[model samples]
Target: MADNIYVVGHKSPDTDSVTSAITYANLKNQLGMKDVVPAAAGEINNETKYVLEYFKIAPPVVLNDATDKKVILVDHNEVGQAVDNIMKADILEIIDHHKIGDIQTGKPIFFHNEPVGATGTIIASMYELNGVAISKEMAGLMMAAILSDTVLFKSPTCTDKDKATVEKLSKICGEDPQKFGMEMLKAKSDIKSKTAKDILFGDFKKFDFSGVKAGVGQIEVMDLADLAPKREEILAEMRKALESEKLDMIVLMLTDVIKEASDLLFVGTAAAKEGFEKAFGGKVTNNSIYKEKVLSRKKQVIPPLESAFKK
Candidate 1:
């Protein structure tokens, strides 16, 4: 039994993934679990970087592979979303909010999967349950995760518990949720600084359905116009990704969080294109489709796409 345990999140680490690992690792250390170290499986995105800098919290060390380490996973469970060598590691526990996938453990572990918008929501309750006081900085980090994942409480994945947890976290951090959320989101909208490949892989995930491979990437912005200039560049990169990864489809969702709409750009097989049409009932014009009231990628995008692929 190794004394050290690594707390890490899924690959293509989002704010919720990074922050939940940090917060949970802190909770574990406070509860007398020594040598609990927080780690990230991928580079932190712009939004997560902004949150860490604002709170003056150091970013977690990047763990490229799990190897023989004892680990706890946060924000995601699928092996595809996990770090390289994750299947070979000793998975001690998992705390996630998404649907479970093909992760098999050697033995029973502490698994907490919930239907909330963010993994941070579940971790916040854990802090209260274990009587661990959340520091102001931790609360702020958790607040950022909640707002980012829920898209300022506008996404369909948001629950009453998510809202209430964010309210308490806001007060703890001495900030207004709407104001802080807007600032955080605006930080991510500076896509002009990143290359097309960077933008495409920033928050990307790969899924497999009956041997059909789909890669979906999402970028949340205040306005879709910001992406218009780089549309061609992004599409080229997506095509390159589809071919390199041998994916049946590659979809990039340009989500306008304020408007609660998504303009999707895709390059894929005819079956994949047909799946999109059947899923949203919107025509893909010039390689894109504008879908209103589409925010959560987990709920609105993946599920519908999966269902359509099955047909």
Candidate 2:
């Protein structure tokens, strides 16, 4: 385990990523572990920004690069998937729900990654086990995060703990899941001036996935139709990104914030296509579009791929 733990989350961070980092940072600090910093790879989305503002909490620190500190990658561990602004960490431990990106440690890393719905739930459990007092605001943030990521425990990635946490946190936060979900979606819906390319890869990640190179980028907004027109533009940008970066594959997730379905775009060689087909069990086309069962990467994409990689 690394002495300095820099807790971070996936790119284009949602509430779960942001809240979990804050809570985890607090825990590590309370445990007398110095140098625990909460960080994010992308700008806070409108809904997440609202959550932070409502709780009177400042946003999590933006991590320009994950390699900047001794990494304790949270919510995501893809070396390429996190902020390119990275500083080398002496010790690295990862606790994420997303597919494990290529993680390289001179020594072994403490990895606790699952396909659970929300990283917030995972971190919440850790806090409960440690018996830390989570403030109402923190609880709200954490709960909101879990709810958003798992679509209020509807996403396939959701677990009993996620549901339980949201239920418990809802009481304290004074938020009804149904009501809050509506409000949250509204917040994310008002997208202005964002191009399809901008929306798609704004919080892009790149990594060395074992021997294979890969990248993951996401666009989470209210309606898929808004992004459809710019589909060609998005694909072009992602295609260039993969080619120039020399990645084996690049996965673009166009998630419908409303329907909870995503069209996965896998761009790369035959090996990358075969990897996705074998892992996700869907037909891969000549181009990159593959319909996926779930929209959220934390719940759907990461878990299956993890299971596949281990096999």
Candidate 3:
């Protein structure tokens, strides 16, 4: 195996996932691991692009397959959400902030898992713990990741640690967290030229709900008005994905960050409909549900759906 280690995050790369990979790899390199590098599992989204541009940091190279490579995972632990062909790779370490999913290694490795909001929060703290002074660029990236994942501290998943990390990072980067965060969100929300498919899969994930295969995507915007016109078009794309992917259910969460709510759009089999109802008690109208205060998919959406499908 190559001695070079690629630090990467989950597919459908969010700001937290992408930034954590870069920040963590920098930390590893600073600690004398010269071969450590950062990589992204998929295309960088607009919000992340804004962050990278603001910090004058380049995006990591995209790594589609991890076969025969050494890797340290960030942001996510689930095999289904990992880079392609990851099972054939040599796992080194995992740093995540979500409930652990199935990703096993032949040997024990450095696995850091916390319930904090963003993986960046953990990576930022690791800089302090390792006695490395965070650079301005790294601080900006970390702050953006925390703000993106926490929806500027409005998400239910946002922890005190995440808030503290962002507060510290903001000072180091000399950017007001709220002001920069809103600008970043505006970048994400501007989907004027994006295809319906692009908007749907820009931040999507796949899951096994019991025996059912489900796909869920989320797009966070400052105003839901931006999506109001394209709702039908997006729903049509969702239906297409449902059949083309052979998924039992496909869901899209059009989240409004300012309002802290989501409009859940889905297309699925009858069984999937039943499970959806079981997950969130509401009548699905026009194949959509308006959920107030539903922001974090990792925290709010997936858990109940997983349980609902199992029953």
Consecutive 10-residue window with the lowest summed lDDT within model 1: 1-10
TM-score of each model, paired residue for residue? 0.97, 0.79, 0.98
The digit string of per-residue lDDT tens for model 2 on 102-155 reads 666677767888767877778778777888777787778888788777765667
User: Which residue runs of candidate 2 sit more than 4 Å off their true CA positions?
Assistant: 1-5, 31-35, 65-71, 83-87, 99-111, 207-212, 269-292, 298-311
Better of 1 and 2 by TM-score: 1
Question: What does the lDDT read for residue 252 in candidate 2?
Answer: 83
Clashes of each: 0, 16, 0
For all candidates in order, the CA lDDT equals 0.91, 0.71, 0.92
Pick by lDDT: 1 or 3, better one? 3
Off by over 4 Å in 3: none
Sorting all predicted structures by TM-score, with the top scorer first, yields 3, 1, 2
Q: Is candidate 2 or candidate 3 better by lDDT?
A: 3
